[model samples]
Target: MTKIARRTEKLTEALRRAGVRITRQRAALLSVLAEAEDHPEAIELHRRAEAVVPGISLSTVYRSLTELENQGVILRHQFDGTPARFEHTETRHHDHMIDVDTGEVVEFASERIEALQAEIAEALGYEIVHHRFELYVRKKDGL
Candidate 1:
């Protein structure tokens, strides 16, 4: 199966396991979530899903997202001064940089930063369990 199909199936199975009935509208939303490459808010997701299958309510989208999040199949990011956005949990570990002017999210991974965080945690007499790091940035004047 294609990657999108696999992701869609994984999401479907997760919802099923969580006892959510796979309504047609919910299926469309799942497909949209699976194909999403950028973090999108619930309203954006609802709009996309509505394009595929009309009559999907915003409340339905919110409820479905809550169910999926509870199932641990997705991660929600509430960046500063923006609505909550979501991405699937299949992505590898990475930190985010949010553009202050455009609300764009950029993902990056750094071994050096990871090591430094670990060292700091050790010095503090604690082991790193889970963490989230975000940087708010703006474009340079000449860029």
Candidate 2:
């Protein structure tokens, strides 16, 4: 099986374990999220999925997405009320730098930030399971 197929399988199993019935709607939602390159909002996801399975209600997309996120099949990040965006959680961990002017998200990582977060979490007696660090920035002098 391909990587995408494997991911879909894992998501299916997760839903079953969570006692959530695996429906066509759920499967379609997961597929859309897995195939998405750019993180997308709920409405955007719904629109895309609708193209595949016409007449799939927006509510179905929203519910399935929320449930999938709750089950850790996907991770959600909120940036400045543009609707929470989602990315598949089976991928690597990285930070994000959002271009405020273009509304584009760029994934990046900093060892310094990662180390600091580890230290802080340890000091607080909490092992960090996950963290999201996003810097909303723009070109100051034109890049």
Question: Candidate 2 lDDT, tens digit per residue, 30-118?
Answer: 68776787989899988887777777788877777777778888888899867788888876879999999888889987899999999
Backbone clashes, candidate 2: 0
Candidate 1 residue spans exceeding 4 A from truth: none
lDDT of 1 at 62: 95
Tens-digit lDDT track for model 1 on 18-105? 8889999999999999999999999999999999999999998999899899999999999997999999999899999999999999
Q: Which stretches in model 2 have alpha-carbon errors above 4 Å?
A: 116-130, 140-142
Model 2 poorest 10 in a row by lDDT: 22-31
The lDDT of each candidate is: 0.96, 0.82
How does model 1 fare in lDDT? 0.96
Model 2 TM-score (2 dp): 0.81
Task: Point out the worst 10-residue segment of candidate 1 by lDDT.
Answer: 14-23
- Per-model TM-score on C-alpha atoms: 0.98, 0.81
